[model samples]
Target: MAPAVVVIDSGENQEFEGKITVYVIVCVILAAFGGLMFGYDVGISERKHVLKNNYCKYKNQSLQLFTSCLYLAALIASFIASKVCSKAGRKHTMQTASNFSLLGVVLTSAGVNLEMIIFGRIFLGFGIGFAIQAVPLFLSEIAPARIRGALNITICETPTSLIERNKMEKGVKVLRKIRGVENVDNEFDSIVHACEMARQVKDPFRKLMKPVSRPPLVIAICLQVFQQFTGINAIMFYAPVLFLTVGFGNDAALLSSVIIGLVNVFSTMVSVYLVDRTGRRLLLLEAWEAILVVIMVCIFVMGFAWSWGPLGWLIPSETFPLETRSAGFAFAVSSNMFFTFVIAQAFLSMLCHMQAGIFFFFAAWIIIMGVFTWFLVPETKGVPVDSMLDKVWKQHWFWRTYMADDDCTTVVKVV
Candidate 1:
C-alpha cells in the first residue's frame, strides 16, 4: 500500500516558541487606542446633559441634532474609508483618524456656535468611521492564523498593530513575535497573495459586487444593521432618561448608566477570551438576542454588551475576500453608522410616539437577525485571512456547516 500524505492546515492549533514580545504588546496597545476613541465617542453622549448645561444656547432639539450629527457624518465618510485605506495603507489611515479626532475635540471644545460644534462633530464622526474600518483590518493582516481570531476580537474591542503597507518582510518578522505563531512562512505567503490579488483587481468596486462576493457582503451588512437595531445606540444615547422612566432618581439613573458602561467594558474583556476558544458562530448565535428588546434600558445594554458588542466589529472584518476586504468593511461600517444615525435621530421621537412599543419593534428585528445568523455567519475561528474568500465561495451561501473531518471543507446539502 502506498503511504498517504497527511495535510496539515496552517490554521490548525500549533505550539510556538518564546513569550509574546514587548514590541508586539506595544503595537497592540497603540492600535487599541482606536477602540478607546470609539468607546469615548459613543459614551460621550451619556454626558450630553453636561454639554447642554454648558451651552445654554442649545435647545433640546438642537442638542439631539448635535448628538447625532457625528453618526451622520460617519455614515457618509464610511463609504470613503476603503478607498483611503487602499491608497494610504491601514496605519496611515488610523493616524489620519487620530488626527481628525484630535482636531474635532479641539474644535468642539472651542466652538462658539452650533455650526462650529456640528462641523467638529462631523470631523469626529469621519475619524470614527475610518478607525472602525482600518483598525481591525490592520490587526488581522499582522496576526498568526491560530490566534488571528482572538487578535481580531481584541482589536475590535480594544482595536491594530503593524504589518502590510508594502513591507512583507517586516510583517513576517512581526508575525513571528506574536504568541502561537510557530512558522511565519504560510502566514506571510497568504498576506503576499492577498496583496497581489488586491493589486491585480482592476475595479475593486465591481469586483465586490460580483456573485461570489454577494453572500459575505450580505452577511456583513446584516450583522451591522442588526447590531444597531438591537437598540444599543438608543440605550447608549439615552440611558439616564430611560432609567428615569422606571422611577429612579436622576442620580441613580446616571449611576445605573455608569454601571452599564462598566459591564460593557467587562463583557468585552470576557468576549476576547471566549471568541477564539468557543468559535465566532457559537458565541454570536448563542448570545442574548431574545432579551434585546426588553423594556429596561439597562437590560438591553447588558444584552448588547454580552452579545453583539464585540462581534459587531469582528464579523464584518472577517467576512469579505482579500481583494474586496477594505471595501466590504467600509460598506459594513457604513451600514452600522447609518443605522446609528437612524436610531440616534429617531429614538427619542419614537419614544414620544410609540412609547414602549418601540421595544417590540426592536424585538421583532432582533428575531430576524437571529434567524439570519443561524442560517449564515460561518465560524471563522482559525481561518486564515487570505483563505476567507475561497471559504465563502466553497460553501452554500445560506446553508452550510463547518466540518470536523477537515478544516477547509464545508458540508452542503440541498433542501
Candidate 2:
C-alpha cells in the first residue's frame, strides 16, 4: 500500500480523517485468510486428485465428490450462518469458521479412504460457509473507514459498532485505542443511527423480502450466480485437467495450472488498488474485453482475478442496510456455494462432452453478466455501506422504484 483517498461523509456528518493505523491493516489481512483458505482447497484438491486419476477407476465421480463436497457443506452452512452472525458477532463467527477449517484440514490431510475424505470435506464446507458469510460483511463494515486502499481497520468491531451491540463503554475505549487525534463522534453517531434503525426492524430476514432489500439482494444473488457461471471456478477447480484437455502433458498441465493460480493471486492484489479508483461497475465491465477473451490463459485469469473475483464479494457486502447485511449476504454466499458445487461436480463431464465448446458456453455467460453490470448494477464506489439505499440504489433509475412507498407523492430522495 498506498494512502487512502480522503472521503468526506455525505449528507450531514463531519469528515472522517483517520489514518491507516496498523490495526486496520491487520484486519484487512485477517479478512484475506478466508479467501486464501477457499482458493487453496479448490486448487490443492485438484492437484492431488489429478495426479492420482490414472489409478482411479471412477475419476470423474470421485473428483466431483471430493471437489464439490465442500461447496455443498458450505451451502448448508450459509443457511444457518445468518443467525449465528446476527447473534454472535462477526469475531465469534469467524473464530468458529477457522476452527471448522482447521479441523477439516486435519481430517483431510490424514484421510485413508474416500469415505474419510468426503467426511472431512463436509467440515470444510461448513468452514467455507461461515467464512464467506461473515468475511464480506466484515470487510464492508470495516472498509467504510477507508473508502480506498485496503478495506479494514481493527481487530474487534469498530468502537461505534460496540454501541449497537450494547457495549458502549468498550466501543469508546476501543475507538480511542485505534483512532488518533481526530474526532470520531460524528462517525460514531452515524453508526449508532444505522444500528438504531436496524434494531427497530424486529426481523431483518423478513425485512429482506421487502422492496428496500430487493435491489441489493437481487444484485448480490445474481452476481454470485454470474460469478460461478463465468466458468472461472470450473477452470480453477479443474485447472490441471483443463490444461490437459487443451493439449498439455501431465507435468506441463500441472505447471500451467500453478502459473494460472499465481496469476489469479497477483491480479486479485491489483484489484485492491483499482477497485475504489475505477469504480465497481467499470471493473466488472472488464469481462467484456474481447482482446483478453481471445488471449492466453494467464491473461484470462488476470482479467477474472481483478474483476469478478473481488467485485463479487465487495459489491454485495457493502450494498445492504445494517438490518439485512448478514441475512442478505447469507443468500449471496449460498448462491455462490450452490453454483460452485454444481460446476465443480459437473465440469469434468461437461468438459468431456462439450469439448472445445465449453469455452464458448462460459464466454456467453461472461457477455450476459457484462451487459447486466452495465444496465442494472449501480456504481457503488465512494458511498458508505449505510448510505447505499439513499446514495446508490435509490439513485439508480431502474432500482429507484423499489425504494418508494404507497404515499403516491412526497417522500425523501433515495439515490
Give the range where candidate 1 is weakest over 10 consecutive residues by summed lDDT: 1-10
Give the top-scoring candidate (TM-score).
2
How far in Å is the alpha carbon of 413 misplaced in model 1? 25
What's the distance in Å from true for residue 316, model 1?
1.3
True-structure lDDT of candidate 2: 0.73
Q: What does candidate 1's lDDT look like per residue over 1-415, in tens digits?
A: 1101111244332222334445545666677678877688767777664433322132377767887889888877777878888776777788888898999999989999999999999999989988888887766654544555455423211111223356655555655555334555544454454455456667867866755567667878888899999887787777766655544556766776777787777766666677702789875653433223223455566567756877778767765655677888888889888888888877877876677798899999999888877877777666554455344435555533322235233211000
User: All candidates' TM-scores?
Assistant: 0.78, 0.87
Estimate, for each residue in 186-290, the C-alpha lDDT of model 2 and write its tens digit. 555555555665687798789788876799899999999999998888878777776555445688678777888888888888887887027888755654442
Give the Å shift of residue 32 in candidate 2.
1.7
Top-lDDT structure, candidate number: 2
